[model samples]
Target: MIIGTAGHVDHGKTALVKALTGVDTDRLAEEKRRGITIDLGYAYAGDLGFIDVPGHERFVHTMLAGASGIDTALLVVALPEGIRPQTREHLQILSLLGIEHGVVALTKADLATDRVADVTVQMNELLSATPLAGAPMIPVAAPTGQGIEALRAALLASVPAARGSGGHPRLAVDRAFTLSGAGLIVTGTLVSGRIAVEDRLVLSPSGLELRVRGLHAQNQPADHAVAGQRVALNITGPRLSRDMVTRGDWVLHPAIHAPTDKIDARITLLPDFRLGPDSVRGPDSFRRMAPGAHALRQDAEVHLHLGAAHVMARVSLLDTDRLEPGGDALVRLTLRQRIGALARDRIVLRDTGATRTIGGGMLLDPFPPRRGRRTPPRLAQLAALEAADPIAALTGLLSVPPGWTDAAAFLRARNVGADEQLDFGSFVRAGGLFLLANTFDRVRDSIVAVLGAHHRAAQELPGLQAERLRMALPDRPPVAGFRGILDRLLDQGVIAQDGPWLRLPAHRISLSPQDERIWAAVMPLIAGERFRPPRVRDLAQALKLPEAAMRMTLKRLQRMGKVTEVAPDHFFLRETMAEMAAIAAATADADGLLTAAALRDRLDNGRKVAIQILEFFDRIGVTRRSGDVRRMKPDWPRLFGGGG
Candidate 1:
């Protein structure tokens, strides 16, 4: 369990830590000389690890970096000073970051022995509304060891249970340096997942692969580390140096290495600023703005802090143009550079000048679309993502417009493990895609509706072409996903396919009596030599029929779905086309590529006819061709009857 110290500066936070763990967290000479903490420092007590953060307002960003992954906060408030500005600000920050468990420490009790009771009452009032409302408050003075044992006992009792190691490993690097013998070392809190020696991970925002050579967990040498612990990793990578990594970067599994520049989130604007007892804002700073100036306007530039990294960002209000103080709304943040962020990661927003904390909230969607963000459907999506239950969130997303979600991305964003058990209830899964069962039914019905309309409008045509039918749908799903829907409909006998055309299974066309007579003679001639059907000129010569007449009759047969035009003047029977497709499918290599010569060898047909057959498949989306090879497409099984 990790415990982080939070309170105002010069409040004996560092001194109290020394009394508890006997390790001075302020290791830098500058910090020692200045009697302040400039960066994060760590100390350990048995199973408990404490992150001692700076209490000064200017180093709040650094403090936030250390506080992000702590399980319990050790709120430090000096007795005589009561609750200072940094104390209140840090409390608000801890609340925004979702810290639930904590213990309050009233430091400097020796100097203000008479005021301890009054300060304790004030602390209780402040804690009454936050997550740690009923937590215990202890007074301690490090100089005289007053109440030191009581505070230590309180901290030990506040440690949360060990979290399950069922997520991908993600260590938010707050410190990076190189040792003479170790090469490179990065240390931070293991927020989730697990890591072990020899495990390969990626350093995000840089895309460098790292191999963990050694590690320490909670100041103890260990072979493996789990979530909710302070972890230091000695790693090596190609072209890797300490400079390539920084405090804000992430060392995580490659599967979770997505760096995004734009995010959709739920934000709460902090109410009008109230100057604390000891005001720190400079004279020129806008500590006192006009009545409504604090309202955040649309496209307002601000500083965003996540983990230990801070960058400039522009806020685009989704629900309102001007968000009044203390108001809540959905928003979009466009960052100046990509950050390794994920869903539910807490973020803080500061003024453009980076002087004052404006507001903060939880991130919803890290890879939000660039446009249509303000639409009603998108707002619904944001609301769905806010749900704590994964199933509830997925249901909301799959029930909205364009009712489908990428299954892998959804699970990854939620940090759900592959082994986690979740009951999605009723849904349709096509590879990595997921959709509501009702949505799948609607899409299937839409496909039949589109084909029925096309068949009714054009009685002479066999059916609507596959690509045209796909474009006609309201929810234009990707080609691979659309094919899955078609396969389902075809299997249920709700729809039929002919070459690359789709139609209702009941739809059919009748041939004219005179045209039927021409088709009767042409059918046998083509069917006799199925694999290598004769061209129009050869058929016309054999029947002593007019060349134009033979061509017209075959063209009419083609429209009726009886034959397919393999070339300009050549055609094949419908059954013969299915047979050839099966042959090509069987002859193709593992990568799905087949040479024309290979097809010729399988069919025992001449090379010219083989090329023509393959070319015909290419035009109908059954296969794609390169210089001398053709690869069967995902829709190959749907070419004749429908299965793929």
Candidate 2:
């Protein structure tokens, strides 16, 4: 377990850490010379790691980086000074980051022995309002070792058990530098998942892929590390350099490398925010009346600190134009630069001047839509994202308007593997997307209704073409998912495909009387040798008819969905075509690729005829060809009632 120290400057946070562990946290020459931590420092005592952060107001940003992934917080309050401004701010930041357990160390006890009781009361009052309420407060002086053993025991009791490997690894880089012979190395908390030596990772925002050459977990050399540990990785890549990677960048799995520029979140303003001149009047008037009361107004530019990244962003209010001090509301943050963010990632909001932290919140949707952001449906989706359980959140999202959810994107944003075995209950899967079962049924009925309207308007035509029919739907379903719905309808016999057209099962076209006689005479001749039927010229000569008339009749038959034209003037009966498709589906290899020679052997037909049939399947979207090999397409099952 990793423990992060939090409190005011010169409060003995570093000294206490050194008393517990032999290593001094302040490593920088400047830090040692100045006797104050300007950046984050690290120390370890066996399995417990300590992230020592600067306590000064100016270095709060640096403190947040170290505080992001700690299992427990060590609150270091000076006994003589009691609680100070930074002590409060750091505690609030810890609570915002969701640190629920901690131990309080009232340092400088030797000097303030008489004042320890009074300072303890002050600490108790402050702790009562935060997540660390019942935490034990021990007084210790690093110089004299007063209460040192008691403080150590309290800290050990507060450490939570080791965390599980939950998802893909994401390390927010807080420090990056080059070693003389070791190449480039980065150190940060392993936010999630596990990382092993030699694992390939991608540096986000710039998308440079790198390979991990070595690693140290919890200040010890290890071949692998899990989440909730401070890790140092030695990584190398062709385009990589010490300068390319910085404090704000992330090194993560390639699958989790998406960087987003917009975020929808619920932000709460710090009670200390000063009311601006344009602050709106309301129940928060009492707060405005305070000397420094302020409001966070819409379109206000601010500094957004997430992970280790700090970027400028413009806040767009969703539920209100102005947010009073100590008030919370839903809002959208449009960032000036992209950052590697994901759902539930904690964010710190600072004023544009970077003077003080105004507010902070958790990200709901990192990849939010630009339009209709204030709509009720979008708000409902945001509400659903508040659920702590991913499955429950997905259940809520699947029930929202249009009832279509991009399942892959939702899971990916939460660091949940899309291929993981999740029980979605009754939600229907359409390729990588999902829809409510009821919504899918409505889509099915809508498809039938559109076809019925088309059949009424154009009685002479067979039906509507598949693409045109899809375009007519109100939902405008995606191509891959729409094909799945169409296949289900066809399998259930609720819809029928006539050539390239889709229609209700009852729809049919009648041949003219004169054409009817010719079709009757031609049916049996082709049926006798359906696998290798004669061409239009041979059929015309057999019937002693004009070649043009035979071709015209065949083209008319094509429209009626009686036959498929495998090649120019060469046709096969619908039943025969379905049979050939089944043969191809059965003959393909495990990889779904089949060659003309394979199909020819299966059907005992000539190689030329098999090639012609395979080419036809390609044009109709059944198979995709690469050189001599053809692989079945996702919609290969759509044609002829789906043989593949």
- Name the lDDT value of residue 514 in candidate 1: 74
Residue 513 Cα positional deviation in candidate 1, in Å, after optimal superposition: 4.5
Separately for all candidates shown, the number of backbone clashes (residues 3 or more apart, or on different chains) is 0, 5
What does candidate 2's lDDT look like per residue over 438-472, in tens digits? 98888988998999998888665678767788899
Scanning candidate 1 in windows of ten residues, the lowest lDDT window is 273-282
Pull out the clashing pairs in model 2: 274-293, 274-294, 275-293, 275-294, 637-642
Candidate 1, residue 465: how far the Cα is off, in Å? 3.7
